[model samples]
Target chain A: MNKNASRFLAGPYIIWMIGFTVIPLIMIILYCLTDGDGAFTLANVAAIATPEHRKALFLSLGLSLVSTLICLVMAYPLALILRKRNVGQGSFIVFIFILPMWMNFLLRTMAWQTLLEKNGVINGILSALHLPNLAIINTPWAIILGMVYNFLPFMVLPIYNVLIKIDDDVINAAQDLGASTAQTITKILIPLSLPGIISGINMVFVPALTTFVISNLLGGSKILLIGNVIEQEFTKGSNWHLGSGLSLVLMFFILVSMALMAKYDKEGEGTAF
Target chain B: MEHPLIDLVNISKTFDNTMVLDDLCLSVKENTFVTLLGPSGCGKTTPLRIIGGFEKPDTGKVIFDGQDITNLPPNKRQLNTVFQKYALFTHMTIAENIAFGLKIKNKPKAYIDDKIKYALKLVNLDGFENRSVASLSGGQQQRIAIARAIVNEPRVLLLDEPLGALDLKLRQDMQYELIRLKNELGITFIYVTHDQEEALTMSDTIVVMNQGYIQQMGSPEQIYNEPENAFVADFIGESNIVPGTMIRDELVEIFGARFACVDKGFGVNRPVDVVIRPEDIDLVEPEKGTLTGVCTHLIFKGVHYEMEVTTPDGFEWLVHSTDMCPVGKQVGIHVDPFDIQIMNKPESEDEEAVGVNE
Candidate 1:
């Protein structure tokens, strides 16, 4: 088979990527750089400095950052425990962690909203026991909670995959070479599992940063994230140009993260999914 | 001898109701190169792991330098192991892999650098400091693993088939290199291997094991020439073991002919196993020979011709000689009384036993 003819096997996938991913990105760029009259101007992109948009962007950044941090702190130890248990990738233990991902993501976020509401299940139980009502709904804390709940598996899977692939003999060699348990974890395990950690960070942070549905369902449409503002622009206000300009700004962060991923995970070592 | 450096007293281990090491005891002297030689699943590696503190025997005490270290973890023990696969940290450079133990001990940068240089030089891998471990060849990686273990200057060094991955030539070269290193460093080395020639080439003491039991422990020459039983005799080298009867003191009968021998203590008319090494048999004129046989087959064995001589009664004798004998040619085979080794028949049938004594 000649090389040119053999390349035809990927024809459908190439066309799909270009049509769905590349073309949409190009259209968003064009919209971000032009007005409704089709005249190119920087005004749409610069409109991000407006107080409402700026506040939403910062809130999204803060809430996503907190959610990513919590996911990392919670996921690392869990991944390490799973690896220590010698759990296979398709084992019931891993299936439990992935079970939540099987549920519809919006339903999961809405379920959290019900739990965090003033008279929700948790608050009702608390009041019945003469405890204080569970209070942090329609706030950044609830949004962060929803983000963590929805995306925790994103942090666990890659780290677990990487950890499981690390050779047991390497860890044994480290210990035989006089490394304490703490030193072995830091010097051997962590350094060896870096690709997975970076992948997990990218997975958790990207989704948490761009989520509008969780904020809308749990934040009562009051605490506006950048995603919510963009949603309103596209759906309610019918401002595609401004929404695309903000999306372009968000894409810049995503691109930076992708560059970091390329640097750390060139071999795609942690990509189990 | 000198006070033992490491003593594993009555060690026994079982995994899931299957015994791996059964009441095994071993002691090592300081600066001696000891080898545990056995076939696979003979439990050779378990003892090495126990000494390195990687495993705890289900029922035994590991005593090092007269202090009990039975419960010590690998990190707490003053020992290091070169794993079967080398196990070099792929994330680190060669220099960093060799410097791992030193860094953990919090050695100064200058000292660590000097130690790394010395270790690399010792392993003959000088100038590989910045090279990544994954880039090195199998032989080079094995050398780096050796350097990594030796850099710590531990009291004892354990190697678990460290050269198993190398080619034949590299394995032979590393065998000498390991011997030289042991002499230069003066650290006790406990090596585990299933290769008999390797065990003979490098070990000061060879402990032959079988089915989780020590078959024999001796110097290489003793193991080769004076095997204690049929198993040791067969395992060490080639031998022609024949069933015979001990007629009287210093006499044995085989093929209905009497032959003088050196072994003793078997009662008259008692059944015994008689061993004769092939090289010990000589081709003589038919009338001057002890037995007459026809050459059945011949193979050129580089240094000699290995001829199978069949006696009139139909027993085949494997003979190694520089002089080639033609097939079907009648010849006389001579044996010296000193070359015949008589042993008692093993109590149990060992299907794998194949060697004869000389």
Candidate 2:
């Protein structure tokens, strides 16, 4: 058989992408370009300039940025530890991180609500010990926590995968050349694993930026992210044009993030560590 | 009077349940190229790692320049390694890789730049400072690895089969390059390799090892000519290690023929192992020789003809000679008495056949 024959195997996925991704994307663009009467108007796209929409957009950006940073700060060291332990390819630690991802994402966020609620599992235990009762629920901090909880594996797997692939001999070479452990990590490990790091940032940041589900469950009704606003625009307000317009604005940020990823990771080799 | 530059005193290492180095002791002189030569799993690389501080021996002290440094980490040790795969930092440029040690020490930028240039120049990679390590060929990477280590101006250099990855031609060229680098650096080198030819060509002393024990350690010539046992003789070069008996002082026997030999000290009829190089045997008329044999096989080997001669008793000898003897032809096997090397029987083998030479 010709080796190119294997390319035919991707036929189903290509068709799926066209139907689910391409058509929906075209519809979104058309909706964003029109008003409710299907007449052309720039007002829906310009709605993002309003004070309420601007606050939601910046809030989404800042919160997600913080969440992505927390996930990175937490994941890189964990990945480094796993790599030092020679963990790769079906290690229990990797499986543990990936297990929560297999559970329903909304269910996992709701479970976190129970854990972080004022009179829930965590606070009940704290109060029994006469400690401070947990009250960060229905706040930006809770949403950030939920975002990190849901998306941490995305950051861990790639960084761990990349770190493990680095030859142990290279690390030994660094130490042999008079580099301390910290210097070796900074000079060799981080630079060598940059592809995975960028891929990880893209993975966690993009999803965290566009998520309305976590904020809805954890932030209650007070905080409004761009995603929550966009969700409300379509569902409760029955305004698909304004919703699609806001989604396009959100996509511009996603595209920029993706471009940043593509510039550093040309191989598209980032899926996991 | 000079003390040894590095002394590994009774070093022992074990991995899992197997002993990798069995109470090994080695002393390396300053400015000398010493090689740890053995087959894979014979614990050659382990000692080099121990010396480089990449491995800690389970027992014994690693004394360097009169200081016990068994507990020192690799970065604190005054030595560097040229790893087998040339472990250049893949992320760094050649100059950055070479300057890694200096940068860690917080050296002045000008001093670092000058050292990088000097190191690169020494490795003949002077203009390759900006080239990434991944861009270099295997040989170039090997040079960069050497340059990276030497840029630190370490007193000792540990090389763990650094040329094992290169092709034959490149490996040979790098052998000369390494010898030149070693002399130019004036550093004590603890080199590890299994290639006896490479060890012979470059090392001032060759330490032959087997089964995690030193079989013999000496000069290249001494190792080849005066192997302590059958294993060393067989490992260092091709040999016909047959069972024999030391008949008396300066006399021995093989294949029912008594030949005048130079070895003694074995009691009469004591079983021994006899070593004879293929080149030592000469072919002549059957009647005018000590023993007669028929040429069984012959093949021309570029520089000489390698032919197999079989005796009447089915004893086989691998002979390399300029004179090609045709198959099935009757020939005389002539060996000069001085060419005979007698060794003690290996401990593991049972004392059985003892052929006589007259």
**Model 2 Cα lDDT, one tens digit per residue, B88-119:** 88777888888889999899999999999998
Cα error, candidate 2, residue B271 (Å): 1.1
- The sequence of per-residue lDDT tens digits that candidate 1 reaches over residues B43-136 is 9999998888877899989999999999999999888899999999999999999999999999999999999999999999889999998789
Model 1 error, position A30 (Å): 1.3
TM-score of each: 0.94, 0.96
State fnat for each of the candidate structures. Answer: 0.91, 0.88
Candidate 1 ranges with C-alpha deviation above 4 Å? B283-292, B311-316, B348-358
Tell how far residue A34 is off in model 2, in angstroms: 1.5
lDDT minimum window of 10 residues, candidate 2 chain B = B349-358
Listed for every candidate in order, the interface RMSD values in angstroms are 0.7, 0.7
- Model 2: lDDT of residue B229: 84
Tens-digit lDDT track of model 2 for A147-263: 999999999888888888788899999999888999888889998888899999999999999999999999999999999999999999989999999999999999999999988
lDDT of 1 by residue, A197-248 (tens): 9999899888888899989998887999999999899999999999999988
- For every model shown, the clashing-pair count is 1, 12
